[model samples]
Each structure stands twice: as structure tokens, then as C-alpha cells.
Target: MAKGIRFHYLHRDSGNYKKFGHRDFSNPNNLTVEEITQRIRQALIDTEFFYPEKVGIPKFLFHRYGDDFSWYEFESVEEIQTHYLHESIEGFIAKLLRDG
Candidate 1:
């Protein structure tokens, strides 16, 4: 099964795009990836199913030329492209901003 996760996104003034993921906290406001492994110290006090211990950003994403820049799991890449064909330029802008 595909693992799905929601991210925290910070928008821009032009409403062009919003950046998300661990980058929002660690990177230079760019793309970043974090991997966490859960650990429970005291099962009695901690009711959470999982408690993550490690938190670090991916090295490559913030780089100008990185794999993530070329390809990312954008929520709505296709819909924005379609709007360019069927509507005005603003319509394309509208669709692109809807991405997460």
C-alpha cells in the first residue's frame, strides 16, 4: 500500500506556491526531507501509538540542482496543467495555487 502523509505548507505573497514538509522548520525555506523512528520510553505515561526520536533534514533537496526539484509528489500537478488549455492565464494560476 502507498503511504500517504499531509504536510504543513507556507504560502507566498503572489500565491504562486507554498512550501511544505520538514523544510518549513529546518531548511532555508526550500525542500527538505526528514525520517523519524518512534520510540517509547515509558509506556505507562505515553499513550501515543508512536513517538519519533530522530529529526533531520535531507541534504540534497535544498541544493539548487537536486532530484526532488525535478520530481516531487505534488498533490495536483495535472489539474493545473489542464487549466492552461481550457481557460485564461489566471485560471492556470488559480489551479497551480491549489497545490499542497
Candidate 2:
């Protein structure tokens, strides 16, 4: 089987980056969307459990709250096949069960 890809979700944790670090997401001075996204992608790779297709980061917060990360699980990649255009965690799980 081809290895699954992990996707990391991200957002500001604090008002500024002082508590976290210079490159922290919460830092007002650190306004780099590409850099932030890159960090998230890196985190996902480090974790290596979640799949990118099943994960999403909406332009606007879907479940607006603290921490700014959410995750779903799958048994196989087929569960994630149709999510490119229209995907959700629930669909991913359902498709996973349906395929197997």
C-alpha cells in the first residue's frame, strides 16, 4: 500500500508570538500565510497518522474554537478517494467502512 499522508491544521494560539516563539502563529508580527501553511504541513509529516485528503482547513473556521486543530481517522486510502472536490470527516469514515 502507498503510505498515507498526514495533514496538520493550524491557527493563532495567542494574540502575539512572544509566548510561543518568533515564528509562532499567534504572533502579530509573523504574518506569513505561506510560512504558516508550511509549518502545518511539516507538523503533519512529523505526526504521520492523519491523511491529507480527509483533513481540511477552511478559509474561515468551520468549528471556531481554541487550539485550532481537528483530526479524523481512516482504515484505508479508498475512504479518502472522493474528498478532493467535496470531502468531510464523516464521509471519509463512511467510505472507509463502505469500501471494506
Candidate 3:
């Protein structure tokens, strides 16, 4: 099986970046029409897991399979599979269950 990918989901508690601070979505360069649409679509979804009061949205920061410094924002983990040979943690578990 291929190696799994590493990613960090950014929330309020994450370290502040130079421009966007802890919220990458706040950056104009990072915001997209798709993201705006997604926000509205997921607005009813609970965010208490990452925020105290459904305040912040979960944003994925994925890095290249082996390189730590190559982090990039992606809409979803499944999207990463289209570009890299790495798999998500959920995918890893599913494969294990099927192959075992």
C-alpha cells in the first residue's frame, strides 16, 4: 500500500501565520468562490469540535507526502488523492479492513 499523507486541520488554536493569522480563510488570496459556497453549504454543520461555539470552519493544510514545508490548502482530503500517491487516514483504515 502507498504511504499515508500528513495534514493539519487549522482552527482557532493554531499558531498565527504572517498574513492570515490562525484563520487561513481570512486571507483574500486563499478565499475562493467555491470556498464561499462551501461555507454556506456547511453553515448548518456543527463546528464545536474545532471551535468553542461553532465559530470557526475547519480548513485542511496538507503537506507533500515526505516534505513538511510544502503545506498547501486543499478543500478536502479526497482531493489530495488526485494529485499525490498518498492516502488519507480514513482510506488507510478502510484498506486495512478490506485486506486483512
Compare the candidates by lDDT and give the number of the best one. 2
TM-score for each model: 0.18, 0.22, 0.19
**Model 3 per-residue lDDT tens digits across residues 3-100:** 22332232222233311212222221323444433442343224212221233223335322332322222223212112334333433323223321
Looking at model 2, report the run of 10 residues with the lowest lDDT sum.
17-26
Name model 3 segments beyond 4 Å from true: 13-48, 51-75, 78-88, 91-100
Ranking by lDDT: 2, 3, 1
lDDT of 2 by residue, 1-100 (tens): 2222222233332332211111101222322444433433334434223333343322332434555443322221111112133333333334323331
Off by over 4 Å in 1: 1-68, 71-85
The runs of at least 3 residues in candidate 2 whose Cα sits more than 4 Å from the true structure, single-residue gaps closed, are 1-25, 46-70, 73-100
Writing each residue's lDDT as its tens digit, candidate 1 over 6-93 gives: 2222212232344443221112122212221111111211322111111122322343332322222222111111111222323222
* Rank by TM-score (best first): 2, 3, 1
lDDT of each: 0.23, 0.30, 0.29
